[model samples]
Target: MVSYQNNISSIDNNADADIPVAQYVRMSTEHQRYSTENQQLAIAEYAKRHGMRIVRTYADAGKSGLRIDGRQELQQLLEDVQKSDIEYRAILVYDVSRWGRFPDPDEAAMYEQTCKRNGIQVIYCAEQFSNDGSLQSTIIKNIKRSMAAEYSRELSVKVFAGQTTLIKKGYRQGGSPGYGLRRQLIDENHNIKGMLKRGEHKSIQTDRILLVPGPPEEIETVNFIYRLFLNDGMPERDIANLLNNQKIISETGRPWTRAVVHQILTNEKYIGNNVFNRVSFKLKMRLEKNDPSKWVRKDGAFEAIVPIETFRQVQAVIEKRSKHLDDSHMLEILKAILARHGALSAIIIDEEDDAPSSMTYRNRFGTLLRAYSLIGFHPRRDYAYLEINRTLRKRYPDLISEITSNIEKRGGWVTSNPDNGLFTVNGELTISLVIARCKLGQNGRNRWIIRLDSSLKPDMTIVVRMAICNSTIFDYYILPLTDFSPETLPFKEFNTFTLDVYRVDTLELFYQLTSREALQEVA
Candidate 1:
């Protein structure tokens, strides 16, 4: 357990020692006037009045009380209380809401029980109830928890309603203006203010955001995409490829993907329509795509990038390709394409105008393989390769988050690139992780392929070789980018000294090797 002893302080005026307690302060939003500092002041006044000395402080600034995920200080406070040699007898919170507005009241109770189990009482300074364990206090605390949760529910509803109103009035609710469009800031009086750059928002409360056409090149590119799809009859994937070949990046500053291209082709915003609430993630639950009927839309909300007729033509084409075919017809088309090409793949299916895109097949059937099986077409070799690749793709984000958390726990800062998952530690050493799948070579020897992203040019490359089953990692290879030049590295075993030098059984050594202190000393 990690204790926050560094934040501990004492009041020097009192001669006699007072009961030691820890003040826990949290501010969920900048709009809230009861900031962490204000909470601390209130807690200190309460402690002083009650003849209690605040020995430690744990504060989470600008952290939501909806869940414990981002509240690291609160998590540490619980951990410290659970320790056998805890120094504080009680914890002072501003109110029950400061503890949490967890959707489930039981969750709040459980955390408080944990602290109580460790003999550390949780006292709400602003609440009227005493800290004593009585029936009345328990009832009041439970009611307060429910009220906190209710407050969040009410606030979310109000915020959603406000956003819907804004959308109806032709204001961009949130999120980036898509490719070929820029966010324009305007005041409540509808006076054109100025263009808002990426990651920049209007500082005024009454300012509204609208979408306007971006640079001439980006506008031309958007028009070209529409013309390519509607007039030239190029598929979304081909258009993406063409843009990527031309080195044109998407609005996110990343290489274009078929999905990104398709989104441009389908979204109504490109045709000067304001659409809102197409998806709902209320109470931080899993996101669910709302039905078309549930979507709130306002037409002619902005200047159209593509002509309405051209946009409608593209949508008609997409809908004709998507909704015209039934499951059996789609499968039959896939079978015919497989027979014609002597193999089946996403790219192959996408390239064939006669067949729907691979995404359609995967969504219609559970997966492409399942559709292939239905068509009685199986590959010659084991098709677990695709499954293994899918697992690795899903594991990458989680692994990056875990690695980042580990680095932070060791007193290092991490800056991760969402585009490629490349990250830098302490703004000095960049690191990239690649997962290698174990395979059997022609000689019947276990082998692995480690592909490095040379474009990222990370200082160190951490390669995780998965087991044969692809369920868990076999071992790790922490190699410096300078030591390895090949984009694609083949490994048979770790018998050679050169290979063994980079081999590690765990990632602990990797963190130790890349510590800021260690890197600074080496520098």
Candidate 2:
């Protein structure tokens, strides 16, 4: 049996074997019927009727049901169920929808199957039919899952339509107003309410948000940026540098970046236009950049800070200046900049008046590092470390693929999430693999820095350390989440016995963890 003596802390030791159960509750800004307190009341009543004792509770308050990515309580519950010393025999949820409104109904089923496979039954307290592997229950559950998913889709459409209407009505929908603008709160009749500070929002439903001109200095600075770009024909990088030189920072309270300057020059908000649907990330799915034709726009919606004619002229000039240059020409520009400055960096490349923006180089060559490599420019200091990181990044996908293949070969199921490159093994363990770059320590010993993504909270993390040459795998450290929790960990060639115990030369032991053994038939 798997030892989980130290993993779970919420188990009730006093609860006896006569029907000890756990309750799971989830709320996603829905009606009060789905609130945690109400759900718990219903669950408690059902448990009493069913002769079950509730020993623990798991809840996800104000979380979305579209995906399990942000549902920490649900993730923890799934992780706990796989352990042998779990105190509960069954999990009681308010309803099937509370279990999850997963877009793919199969995802919800897979989670349920994981619990059932581990001998823990998932009991929906409010469902009409019994969850005893009956045909009626299965059909109803599947239908309910589909209905839950459809509800989210319908809500998304209604919300989008409402937002589009508000946009046309000259009210802000979401996101912060740009650098030289401020969010103004107003009433239903458009009476000026007040200016919203950063990170502030309207609490009343009837209140609306509008973009208005900010401080006079900020407005003047906005105009200055346009004049510099249009009249003086200063590049975005040069404008950014000039702002920084004058001790002026962007709205984000950071030194200005070339991209930030370019955004100010191009965005229609400065010209009082409301633009929506430039990008879409609906229902917690993939992000997509919508075409200009698909964008919802309203001309003269916000308070204008820059003249529309000037904005138009700047746009035209920018279009003409950014006319496509062939790869050879681009390289020649980079070579010229490097020869003049005696070095090349993103800032240097962007600062050059005759060269394309560093972003353009990234788009053309995949990365600035790749562009530098093409020109045989190996920069010193941090740039050398960035080169190493680039190589490790290139190797990460292959490593994930290799690990997935090996796990599957051992008869273990692997569900690889394309979004995060994390693997759920056999529907029980979530595994994350990270590459640790090798460095020389102060003591002159080989050291490695392991940065784990604590947000994902994988059940197991495999740190693949690079050798001294920074090309090959030095060794592996398979750490369970219970054993380590820091976001960053530094390791030497040697360590304490407790930590060194987890270090290994190969992944043979890891494969064994996922390996399946055939059982012999008994008479």
Candidate 3:
């Protein structure tokens, strides 16, 4: 009964029947530039191949993938779909995850089902859907999407781990390696930079390879900024704009954000401790703000770029500055900052890769070398040489247990690299590491041990060098009695537990032993 034109018009109303197509593209962080651009290009190419007219293209820039509501373009597209104005033959994208991650998959699947009921189809360019294929295809597609989410999570973990390691190494991890810092590479043997070459943490590790502590000059600059904001009453935004006006880009080549300026003024690394595992989460795929209780902070890992006194002063200033702000809102922002940066304002490390260096070893152990140097232990080598020294496990099987017990008993670090002899819990708060030199002459075989009786847990000392002296003298000190301070300090009961006949020193006995403090500080 109906006319031909009316019949054709009825068929044209179908949303899937429309030839014109629209494209949607998105990226989570500022880092995913290429992947997003590639997706957009792929969508464009698909349009050309299908002979479909190019229509509106929606894009969400700098949007996160954890939640869908935050994406502006996505919401717009959804609203347009609800209005049913234009027929969308297909909503094209590289993959379903390009929609969003986390709660996004469930939300997207629901939205897709609704669209299907409305006579629309989503054409994922990269994912070729097949109904007749193996059941594993569906599982694989789901896994692929899940992996995209996992990829973000894994990347966060790797970045955090890498950065933590680099920060510990003192090679400069980010932002022009804080004042007075110079990057150096550890040779294969883990010696204090076999050559004073570039630090590997900066060049090959993460996006933050040049994360180093402040050098003296830069330390001054850091101090200046902190003082300006707190003592001089300067504002964060004003400081950022001021730095930008001076054409001073941050070490990463980006204009200073107000947040970045604030962080510089508040960071503790500038004082010289390399804290690690401070703000970590199991689900890095959705790294939310971390709880302070969950943070693992190790003090004194590397040589401090800034003075401990200055670092304390800066924290005091920040506390005074932040106290008056709205706690609820500021806490939220702070939480976000913690999630993104783990309380790091700026790191001074090297950004160039050194030969025969793995980014991992440099970051984890290198920080401890710097820390030991700061407290005055004189770390002998760089990350390249840590394995040479870190063999404490092989040398002293009870090393970790001893340290852990000391920490539990005394409850604080005494001193690192104590007397190089028989280490014992002397007083309630004392730990002794014996340092002995074998006499070189006929007397070299007979040695006198210099015992530095210091605090134990309350004053934990990391003994870096067990005995680095004339080789022959090593045998005499190797079996000296001064190794046990508590036994000599009126602890007759402890004497029974101390070693009676000490082992003779050989080339293998001449390695460094980390105090509990040094071990906690590095990783």
Query: In candidate 3, which residue ranges exceed 4 Å CA deviation?
Result: 1-18, 27-37, 48-51, 61-64, 117-119, 131-144, 171-267, 280-523
lDDT of 1 at 515: 62
TM-score against native, each model:
0.70, 0.67, 0.37
TM-score of 1: 0.70
Per-residue CA lDDT of model 2 for 1-523, tens digit only, reads: 1111111113333333247889999998888888999999988887775556899999999989898765768877887888899998889888889999888889999888988888888887777666766687689788998998898889999989998998888888889898999999999988999999997889999999999999999999999999999999898889999999999868976568777899999999999999999999888776678889988888899889999999999999987877799988888888888889888766566556667887789789976767777888776543445667886898887788788888888887788888887889888899999999987665646888777768898999899999865767888888898987673353876553345557777898999999876689999
Which pairs in model 1 have colliding backbones? none
**Counted clashes in each candidate structure:** 0, 0, 90
C-alpha RMSD of candidate 2? 16.7
The CA lDDT of each predicted structure is 0.80, 0.82, 0.48
Comparison by lDDT, 1 against 2, better one:
2
Candidates 2 and 3 compared by TM-score, better number: 2
Residue-wise C-alpha lDDT for candidate 1, range 1-523, written one tens digit per residue: 1112211122223434477899998887645557988889888887776667888999898888887755667777877887898888879898899999888989999999988888887888888776566687789889999999999899899989998888998999888898999999999899999999987988899999999999999989999999999889998889999999999978876567777888898988989999998999887745678889989889999999888999988888888777778888888898899889888876567667556877678778867778889989887665556766886888887788888888887888899888877898888888888999887666645788677667888898888988754657888878887777664353764333344556766899878765655355564
Model 2 whole-model lDDT (C-alpha atoms): 0.82
Clashing pairs in 2: none
Per-residue lDDT of candidate 3, residues 275-307 (tens digit): 445444454233344666644454665556656
The candidate maximizing lDDT is 2
